[model samples]
Target: MNKIVQIDPDQVEDVGPLYAARKKVYPQKVSGTFRRIKWGLMAFCLGIYYFLPFVRWNRGLAAPDQAVLIDLPNSRFYFFFIELWPQEVYYFTGLLILAAITLFLMNSVGGRIWCGYLCPQTVWTDLFYAVERLVEGDRRERMKKDASAHRWTLERISEFVLKHSIWLMIAWWTGGAWVLYFTDAPTLVKELVTFQAPAIAYIWIAILTATTYLLAGFMREQVCVYMCPWPRIQAALTDEWALNVTYRYDRGEKRMSVKKANDLRALGQHAGDCVDCYQCVAVCPVGIDIRNGPQLDCIQCGLCIDACDNVMKKINRPTRLIGYDNDINIQRRIEGKAPIYRIVRPRTIIYAALIALVGGIMLYTLATRSLLDINVLHDRNPVAVKLSDGSIRNAYTVRFLNKRGFDRVVAIDIDGPQDAKLHVVGGDSITPDRPMIVLGRDGTTELRVLVTAPSDRNPEKSIPVKFRVTDIGLGEVASATDNFVAP
Candidate 1:
């Protein structure tokens, strides 16, 4: 037997709506250890991104001299000394695998370090913030200016114009730098400056310029918070052992003003180090309070740590009221136990091992990769033809690749069907037994080939045929197989 239960409508739980309004963040400027580190990393990353394409490499007369190039017209990719053809796209797969594992390893060690210190979004946003700080002012001034109803003063208007102009210049250059990787950087620059570059280049520059301006200038932290998937992915990837930007709530609780804390300390009562100052929140790019515990919006950028350290110093209190720490350590501290770190734990070890294995395999394969390759496609329309002398013949389209740097004579041979003879459509055989053609260095050659065998000696229907191309000088051999059919 079951009893019926009734509830009042007024007692029902009310779930909140899904969406929230956006809040504009005006982060203050602060200087300390993390700020200096961010400055160094920003310089390094931006310098490399803008200038690397201009670097030159000496790859003989036949190849482009750019150190890094994506030769779309020629279907080639050149990175320093390594040249990859379209057929070798697996190298890119290996590279992506390596990148993913490295990111996982980074997340395991330190939460969102990539997002905080090294992400393009963070770097460019930081740069844009610096520009804003330069043109307008620090937190207090900017906040005041924004709050004022009449902010359209001449000085403010001029500052805004100047700031946006600089931003546009930087964004345009960023876009211009991208197109340089596809061609010779110096030549592209010259053409671009003279307004004589390809229309496509200008179109790409416009697109990237708009995106850079909008993302770095306007969107800023929104990109990391709402747009990028990495934040959500890293949230799932993070473990208790990973260090992140954290507030030491254990030391920071029982918050009060500095005067109140000093008086309580003088009275010999429990007084936490936090002065309830909002410095940590003030310097945050994402405008979230660290004291509210870990939030998905926090990028673990460590700027708040710098801000809190500065505040602690000014107040003559201990530093690191906010710092890089893990929840396990925080819990251990609360439990009156020493914190233990296990950077070499199982997950890290596994990720490291896999990275090593994949990296080693890629390196080994690259070192031992063949310099020559061949492909043979047997004709299908007329699979086999009856020749004048009663010999059964099969036609094939053979493609040869010469990965070397100089021209060479390559000999082609056929293996299948008894007493089969090979003939290249336009070539005279170097020897009566094999046909030979000249292969250009670092290029591909396609040619039609015919194979004939005595009709009386032909197999029932089809016989497996192998096409062998040999570099006559280097003695290197490459082979492909197809079926030789009887007419």
Candidate 2:
């Protein structure tokens, strides 16, 4: 038997709500070194993204002229002078490894620099903030308008409509620009304007438009804080010596009013340079106060440094109360010692070495890669058959790849059992042992081949047979090996 126990409501303590509602952030505009750098990078990145597809490269008559194109229909990827096939997907793997190592190197040098300066989210969100500031006034005015009694005034409503219209237009064009990479840019643009483009193109445009608008225009910093995985990964990758956006609390402590601080300093009492100004918080896009120390929310964008510098200049105090600094520097200042930076540490050197090794390997392989290639698949149903003439025959499906822009004639030769004769079922042979086939430009040709050998020469067990394809004119060669078995 168990006794029932009851808990009184009065004895229970309220732990508050499980979730906190999001606080709207209104980032104030500021101009300084980092801001200027962000502006320049944003322009450069957006320019490349919007216009790169229009650049053309001549790849002969039958090949695509687009400088960079993913030709899904032909299973080809063209990048300027280089063309990749499905079998060469190892190049993509190499590229991904290089990218990951580069990111790690960057993190080891500066915390979250990519997220702050180069992320698509940061660039587009900065653009959206500019538009918001232009239409609804700066941070304070926007806040006031939102809190005003007449929230939906005619003038304000008109501004809202204008702002959203511009945002949608930018978002739509962003999506439209992405689709241009798949086809001829100028031709696709004309077709799109005339509503004659493919249904899939329009569908992708719609999807990208919706995502860009929602993410850049509205979601803003939320995407960086919650949606992205880089922050967590960077946290694990970062070291104590890595430079990050930090408030120099050693110099900015014992906060007081600017006038109070000046008076205290005159009396030989120590007062920090910081005057308790909230400007740093106001200019931060993520609304994180750098003085609270580094947080997961901080993107290390250095906007707070700009904001703090502006305030320090106005108050006749030394700048850099907040800056890109490491924890070692902060502790050194407290210990009355000089701060040192070690950008060429062990991890950074290792990352750099790995990047170079991988890059060099890829470059070497790409430069020496063969344009002519072959694959051979032996028939499974009847591995080998003995003919009435006491000859053993083996069938194989051989494929020849002509990666060149022009058609080529290739000769297929087999090296296997003694006294073997190679024959292409429907192909003409330049010699009795070698069968020649014409391969079309930038395509593959499949042929049914029979390799027959005298029964006495056939091995009791399976033997390795090599199929070699040689370009008749250029003498380029590629080979593949398959087993020839006796039934």
Best by TM-score: 2
TM per candidate:
0.94, 0.97
* Candidate 2 steric clashes: 0
Candidate 1's residue-wise lDDT over 132-168, tens digit each?
A: 9999999899989999999999999999999999999
Which residues of candidate 1, in runs, are more than 4 Å off?
Answer: 1-18, 428-432
Residues 355-444, model 2: lDDT tens digits: 999999999999999999999999999889888998888999998888899989888877877878888988766676567878999999
Q: Report the poorest 10 consecutive residues by lDDT, candidate 2.
A: 427-436
Candidate 1: Cα lDDT at 405? 73
The C-alpha lDDT values of all candidates are: 0.90, 0.91
The true-versus-predicted C-alpha distance at residue 472 of model 1, in Å, is: 1.8
CA shift at 418, candidate 2, in angstroms?
1.1
Worst 10 residues of 1 by lDDT: 426-435
Can you tell me which runs of candidate 2 are displaced by over 4 Å?
Answer: 428-433
